[model samples]
Target chain A: MTPAIAVRGLVKRYGRRTVVDNVDLTVMPGRVCGFLGPNGSGKTTTLRLICGLLTPDGGSGTCLGEDLIAGRAAIKRQTGYMTQKFGLYEDLSIRENLEFAGDVHGIADLRARVDAALDRLGLAARQHQLAGALSGGWKQRLALAACVLHAPRLLLLDEPTAGVDPKARRDFWDEIHALAATGITVLVSTHYMDEAERCHEIAYIAYGKLLARGSAAEVIAASGLVAWVATGEGADRLAIRLRDAPGVTAAAAFGASLHVCGPDQAALAAAIAPLRGAPGIVWQEAPATLEDVFIHLMRQVPDNAGQG
Target chain B: MRGTLRRMRAIIRKEVLQLRRDRLTFAMMFGLPIMQLVMFGYAIDNDPKALPTALLAADHGTMPRAIVAALGNTGYFAISHSVTSEAEADALLQRGEVQFVVTIPADFTRRVIRHERAQIAVEADATDPTTTGNALAAVEPAVARALARELTGPLAGLAPRAGPVEVVLHRRYNPEGSTRDNVVPGLLAVILTMTMVMMTALAVTREYERGTMENLLAMPIRPIEVMLGKIAPYIAIGSVQVAVVLVAAKLLFDVPMIGSLALLSAATLLFITVNLAIGFTFSTVARNQLQAMQMSFFFLMPSILLSGFAFPFRGMPGWAQLVGEALPATHFLRVVRAVMLKGAGLADIAAELAALLLLLGLVGALALARYRVTLD
Candidate 1:
């Protein structure tokens, strides 16, 4: 079957600086594709280009099987975009805002639709409260409700869970999964690894370049990261020293223990040879984590520290 | 189209809800008219009265006594003091104690009895041009009446030997010698322009700043439809203001209305729409509420000063009057004052209406063009 959203070698630039440098992405229907990247990694820009909000400097693509450049209006009509900001009327109540969103999208039976959205989001109790007076969690729920009220085929959420509590975040992801189960395609960009793991597939981008794209297990296994734990009187110092040692790629401290990583097993062993003694220092090999693989990937990529 | 209507209704409803919540804005929207009406009506008057003058009657004859009594009877002037010498009268004027000084020369009774050339020296403070003109005009009737009374006396004062005494007062239009009349009419322009434009500019811009505009723009509504929906309510409020100001003009200021109320109301609605369009354009360009207010004020200052509202359009130099004419408020004031005061008909005000309509069309089009339906 044709992919629900597909873009080929999209290139966009601001002035002379290229953001979203030549990248290809495709999202199958009924799947959550998490876009993971550091700040200024062009995730938001890519989303905008795909949604027809901005014209790419160069490339060709189709969104929902329509030529993106020529069919922007159609794509906009069927696409729900949630900006990072809370883009709802603060002075208006949740019910009023939802009603407005429904009316704007030309939804028939707006009152019923708004009521359904509020009920589905579990926000019926606070529907009469002003959006401005809502807490961060409630505001997040309201923003989500407004975005999904149109029942778009694709949902483009930009960092929707930022600054929200963990409970609220979990509840939000549950709602997103329910939407995905209904055959809706979701492309969400987030900085949190837990959220990324919740998606069916993850695409890691760094410095406007796509570094990796795969399922969680595939990405972790493909990273070739070897891990070891060190216990000692000064394990933190040992880890710091082992960072510059040959074959030691990453080093970090974790609660009275030190976790050291490297891509080559033998190199990691040889690198830890010096820490075998030194009085109370203990070194043992351990299982590598997804965070370690991502850190290793981030270390390999050249810095884009000042791109923003 | 149905979707657009739905969205328009949503925006209007939301705006009304917000307006109801913001009591200060509601108060200003309704209360300002009544306050300004009462204030300006009570403060303004056109009929001149109680002008200060000094009498220097060295003649001590029937003619000077008749003149003093006639001038005082006109109720336009009161002899605050009597001066023996021209120097004393000049001192009183220099000190700002008197506006006019009438001097009857020491010709004694012999000149009038001899029927020879007798002259009265009238020294006036010509500093304030408007007041000076009214004072001179007021003294004219008194001088004329006194001469007429003397000539018709039993002694039959010689009318043939008497020469006309010329009183030179400065300035013509609104010669009540009070700035209240001039300032009050101009105040209407200032108050309306600032309040209307600032209020409207803030209306849309607040939505943008508060993030509600994005929601509105996302709707299927056309940009022009949004502009119309926003401006219609202001036009209603503006119409009520017109009626209030007219009633105040008639009842308190005795400012007669000479033109059609219908034409005045029509012009006022056009003016409101034009101003509202300007404000809408500002909202489109401004980034925040503060910026919107600043931009509105910046635009209003020029329209208020350059518009012939505060100053006489003819008195301003050519380039300045050209600037004044460029503002819709200037033309509106001219049309309003003419229709309301001069009773000018449609034929008399057609050009002004055309200019105002042209401005409204241009501004409304520009506002629509400046509006964005989607984020870039």
Candidate 2:
């Protein structure tokens, strides 16, 4: 089967500086792809370009078998782009917003479709309430419901859960999985590591460049980052010292332990050897984490993301 | 571009629903016209009456008093003071306390009895020629009537025919000199332009301000579809405003409507569309709601001041008239006045209709061109 999304050499330049620089991407149908990147890393711009919400400065590709520029309107009809902000009218009732979405998509039996969406969201009870009155999590869910109101072929969610609670985020992931089960392709950008792990494959970008593209395990192994877990009473405080040391890409405190990773095992051990037996700390070699690989990748890119 | 009708209908319905919920803005759409009509009706007077005058009756005679009484009876002048010297009259005119200074020159009643060519000098303030010209014209006929009443039996043959030339002055259409007749019809154009353009100009900008424009453009709706959908509801609003002003003009003000109602309705729709198009074009240029409001205000100032609504169109300078000619309000004003007061047919106002159609086309094209299809 053909992939739902396939684009190469996609570049977007705002004046002199590039926002999405020569990015290439391909996602198969029914596969949930997590787009992970630091802030100002061109993730949102890439999603906008793919869904035809934005024009690419330089690219040649197809979205759902339609030319990116020529068939933009046609592709837009079949693709749902849920912006980072709640784009639905705030003053409108939840049901009204859904009905408006359905209407714009020219759905038949719009009333029934909206009612069904409301049922799925468990928002039928408060269907008449204004969307602005809902909490952050509920608002996110309503926005999600509106995106899928027309049963779009592709979903481009930009940070679907930024400020949502833990339980709500889990429910949102469950909904994504269910949609993916039905062969609806998903390309969701997020900063959360747990959400990144739930995706079938991951694409990590930084400073307008795609740094990694593979499954979470594949990306971590591909980074070849060496890591050591230091545990005991004072290991958490060692993160502050190891963070600035040579060959130590990331040294983050996770609960009572310090997870330190670097490019080479020899240099990494050399950086942490002096503190190995100091006080009540135990060191053990561990596999590098997805978070460690991402920090390493972010460090690799220069900090000239937005400059010309 | 496909399914444009469905998407446009959806947008229109959504706009109307939002308008219904926003009671204040909805009220403004209709209230602005009536309020402005009533406010300007009592304030503006093209043919000002009861202009203050100081009469220096140096010729203390029965004939001079009768002439002054007749001027007052014409409803044009009020002789408030009888000054003894020309200096006092000059001071009153200079201080702007009086619009006109009437001086019955120091002559005895002997010149009239001897049948000499006697002259009565009346000085007028020439500032604001419209007010002075109409009031001064009434003076001659009033003096003629007063002199005819005075020269009854003995001095009958001496009654001046003014000259061999006889002129019959006619003030057609508005005989009562009612300012409301001009104002009420002009209100239709002014109000439609104010409300239609500003409301729609704010509509698209409001979408952008609230960040919903991205979501909207990401749908199947095209730029033209969005423009038409945003303007459709205001057309109905413009119609309602016209109805209210027309009914009030007939019932409350007793303004005459000498033309066909059908022609007026058609012309009004065209004018309203022109304004909506201009407003939609403004929305494409403005980035936020505040900027939209400022742009609408900038457009509205010239439309009201130069559109022949506040002042006579012909009285303005040639270049200013050129600016007025380019405005939709100027043509709308002419069309409405011709149809409502002059009893003009569609053929009589064809030029104005053509102007409105051209404006609609040009502004509509500009709006379409400026509107962005993608977020880029």
Candidate 3:
């Protein structure tokens, strides 16, 4: 499949500080690419640069075979971007919002298109309700409806389900997958590990750098991390005691058990050897989970975002 | 009470620092008042002089010539054009090229020398009550004493009301000197300026403040497209306002309309667009709706004061007249009043029309240049 987006060496600097530095990204057509990053890790900036809402300080490429800088209008025409905040007019009705989106794209047969969008979102019954009055989940659905109104070839969603409930997030993911199945490329930024796991591929960015990019299992295996779980009558209490120990990257209590991970197996074992013999406690080596690797990756990237 | 005072002092300190940090706000605070003071001090004047007048002298004798010269010496009338016929003089007044036309009849010296109550007609464009009121009063006295020194021997008695010489004052266009006649036409420009600029400014600023601008810009629309779209609605609103004010002027205030309606409408549209463009430029520069509102109000204060709407245009000091000339409303006021009261044609008010067009072009270009194509 041809690439829907191909951009290299993207550099965005704000004054003396580089917000997005020497980044490269490409996602094949019809792929659901999940972007996982900590706060202010340039995910939103990168998405904006691709969609032509912002100009990159350096680097160039094509979006949908059109030059990113010169063909910005064409890129914007075929791209759907959902902002982190609800960007739809709150004063307008749901139907009105969709109609306005259609109008912005100069869509003919506006009423019919709006009707179809409303029906797809099951918002026909409350299409007359003001968008601001909708619940968080419904608002999210309305925003999604607006985003897909023009049948864009690519979608850039920035934390689309940040504050949504679990059921709503599941529903949103189901809708996203449905769109992906229809051969529309999607690039969604999220902080949720479960959401990240749902993507066809994952890209992890931290403090303006793309650190890891691959499938979930591949990312975990490539991190070279070791984790051990301890379960006993009172094993979880040892998490606090092991947190400050040398060679241990993270130690946290998971329910009545303790989950701990470190970079090297021997150092991890030595750090927990004394605790391993605790009364009635059993220590078992477990494959490190996706969250464990992500936490470990974040611990390695030095935070230079606060300076200059 | 003491605790409350301490808390209030803390808030004051915080507010002062915030005020100091906002450099633009600080500059405008000190700059606006001082600018207003200098503008008002240099430009505002109650006594207007050098009123453009047209001379149509048919009398060949010394008495009429002496009187015309005295009229010029009084510093009230500046004879800018000379006419041989009444039709030529009439055209000058209708075009609003001159405020008054002074006619010395062919029989003036003959009637005066025969002591037959010789009359001199000074027809004033009385649409502006203040401008013409003083000049008209000065005319009779000024002209009566015109040849006082030249009147020697038996002619001395002719100058001191010993013999009859009548000064026929014809206040044309508006004979009753209705303030509404002047104000109604001027309100067409003033009302449009106030509403169109502020409304368009708020509309753009609201989009930015609500974060909708990013969504709009992320689409395929250009900055010019956005500006035109934002201004289109206000154009309709401005038209409706013009209609309402026009109807009121005609029915309630009994204001006369002597000029071409189509011409007035065309000029009104141009004036409305100019103000809208100015407002749009303000929106791009302003960071928030409050700043937009303040900028609009700041612009309006000078617009209303210096546009010859509240005061006479020629009455203003030279500097104020320059500022007035810079504002669209000033030229618009001239166009509207000229067309409505004097029956000025396109040729008559070409200067005002050109000024408005120039303003529209300058402001429209500035708005497009300031409008950001990308968020960066």
Output the number of the DockQ-best candidate: 2
- State each model's CA lDDT, in order: 0.79, 0.90, 0.84
Worst 10 residues of 3 chain A by lDDT: A99-108
Residues B47-143 of candidate 2: C-alpha lDDT, one tens digit per residue: 8889888888878789888888999998989887778888888998888888888887667366777887667778888887887988898888898
**Model 3 per-residue lDDT tens digits across residues B219-285:** 7776765776667656776787777677766776677888998999999999999999999999999
> Which one wins by TM-score: 2 or 3?
2
Scored by lDDT, the top model is 2
Docking category of candidate 3: incorrect
Which residue pairs clash in candidate 1? B258-B343, B259-B343
Query: Could you list the chain B TM-scores for each candidate?
Result: 0.83, 0.92, 0.59
Could you give candidate 1's per-residue lDDT for residues B290-346 as a string of tens digits?
999999988887786788765567888899888777788898888877776567899
Candidate 3 per-residue lDDT over residues A1-308, each given as its tens digit: 66998999998989988888888999999999999989999999999999998899999988998999999989988999999888887867788678667766767687888998888889899998878899999888899889888899999999999999999999999999999999999999999999999999999988888999888989988999999999988999999999989989889888899999998999999999988778899999988888888888888989978785
Tens digits of lDDT, candidate 2, A80-181 = 999998899998889989989998999999988888899999999999999999999999999999999999999999999999999999999999999999
lDDT, candidate 2, at B258: 95
Per-candidate DockQ values are: 0.47, 0.79, 0.21
How close to the true structure is residue A218 of candidate 1, measured as C-alpha lDDT?
84
Which scores greater on TM-score, model 1 or model 3? 1
